[model samples]
Target: MDRAVLRDDMVDSLEHEAKGWINTESVSLAMRSVPRHEFVPDEQRAYADCSFEQFGTRVLAPSTAARLVEALDPTPDDSVLIVGVGVGYTAAVVAEIVGDQNVQAIDITRRLVWEARNNLARAGYNGVLVDRHDGSDGLPAYAPYDRILLEAAAIEPPQTLLRQLGASGHLVMPLGASTQRLVSVSKDGTTVDEFGRVAFSPMLVDGEQVDTVERNRTVREDREFAARESEGRHGWEQHWIDWTHGQKH
Candidate 1:
């Protein structure tokens, strides 16, 4: 089957009543234009509505990507920053909406950075700049982006990323720890509109990349200390002592 036809079918399913992920025309057109197969390892399953794991990162399914892009609501010429550029599929889709050169992406893992670069090039979106950097820090050189999208989950929006957004810009990400919700936040970090629930991997710090050696001893020690503290707690200390739970002893 033709790749273009497959893309059409994929978008068709996304826009259908059962799964209305692709709402706007921009997102619909962009998803159709970008060749998803070029960014995925398994070309045969590229258009399937399923996620893939590559280089220790998750390649979001088409419906998930469509949801993110639709929430982003990017326009042509908008400067967009994409954190956690897994397989470059989402970046490619964004590149179609915004000009290719207007898209900047970063990943914590160096290998995934290389893979994303190569994948974008193969997909004819070489204009998208991809670099290996901590997603929390963002691509500062190109600060003040019109829109920012973080593909990973974060307990709270990174302050640095919020500072990098243009005065009127907004950021979309999966926010929280145990449970996550897809949200769009204003530049001032005040207004947050939740799209729905979503699940994504936690954002990686500087030394946490899968390819990097485990050399951050401080983090390891902190975890061990917390474990020891938990073990030491007993009886009332086992859980938070609620004065309201008991009247006087």
Candidate 2:
């Protein structure tokens, strides 16, 4: 099957699943225009609406991206910031609506950033900037974006990223540590409204990836220290008895 037809079918699925909740033409056209298969691994089936892993990162499902793009409501001249540039697919869709030069996307993973850059350029979205930076910090060098979207979930959108939003701008993100909600926040440096829910991967912090080995080692050490303290407490408690709760004053 032709890649274009496959992309069109994917967009149709996005429209269908949206169930009239999201049917924005710009969003649909952009979804149809960009080839998702190019960003995804060749071995896997790409035309499906389901999310998959690429470059050790998760791609948002087609419906999720559609809803996010619709909520963002980008314009051709708008400057957009994408917090998680997973394989550059979402960035590409946004770039198609807003010119590529106006789009800046970042990821905490260095390898993902590299893959995004290559995938975006190959897909003819070379104008979209893909970089290895903390999504929380955002692309401050290009501050005050007209629109901002985060592909990861956060308890609250990062202050720094929120600060980068232009006056009269809109930002969308998944709220809550767990049981995430898709939230849309519009601000002009004052007066904010955040509501909605959707689950997504947790945001990377300080632009650093989780070090599982180090984390596990720390957990073990803390447990051992806690056990030692607990054993000592029982021995010392007998000597330092509390009169209020005991027989002796």
Candidate 3:
């Protein structure tokens, strides 16, 4: 099927089966207009409800994107800041609602940033800004976005992103480490609500390095400790020889 036909089919599925999942017309319209195929390589299966993974990034599933857009409730005049422009699919959809120039998306991966930028421009959303930078730090160059949506789940809403919200804006994201919730925080930085539980990739930080001497601990931490700090000390040189020889009194 052609892109238009495929796009329509995808939107229909979302509207009908998504049920109470999608509650806004703007998001519905975005689902209708944005051509998802152009952003991913699976042209034949672009309209599938499943996410397509590529280059360490995955285009979010249709249902997940729709729910996020619904929560954000963007308008034609709104400026939106989107964290994680994985493959530019979600950004393109948001651009359809809030004119292309009004959307700014960032991804920490340089390759994904370049790819998303090129994909969006090719799909006629050249006005959308896709940049490579730390997502948790927030893109300050375009501060005060009317709405912010994070595609990746974070332990908490980054204070930086919360601070960038306009006076009356909404910030939504899948938040948490073990259990995730689709959370919405108001601009004043106080009012918060949860849409539902969700599963998402952990938010990534660009150029982040942990101190080898001590890290909270992941599998990588133990490995790094062994490589950098293990087998070294107890202060007493004689103590080490006594312990190795099993001579404890």
Q: Select the stronger candidate by TM-score from 2 and 3.
A: 3
lDDT tens readout by residue for model 3, 1-249:
578888887778777853555667888788888878788777766788887667766667888888888888888979999998888988998999989999999987778888899889888899999888777878888989899998877665678898999888888988765688898988665637788889877676655322123323323334545755545654364343566567654
Candidates in order, TM-scores: namely 0.87, 0.80, 0.80
Pull out the clashing pairs in model 2.
Answer: 181-197, 181-198, 182-197, 182-198
The segments of candidate 1 whose C-alpha lies over 4 angstroms from its true place after superposition are 211-249
Ranking by lDDT: 1, 3, 2
Which structure among the candidates has the greatest TM-score? 1
Please count the clashing residue pairs in each candidate, in the order shown: 0, 4, 0
Local distance difference test, each candidate:
0.87, 0.76, 0.79
Report the candidate with higher TM-score, 1 versus 2: 1
lDDT string for model 1 (146-179, tens) is 9999998876778899999999899999887668
Error of 2 at 72 (Å): 1.1
Clashes of 3: 0
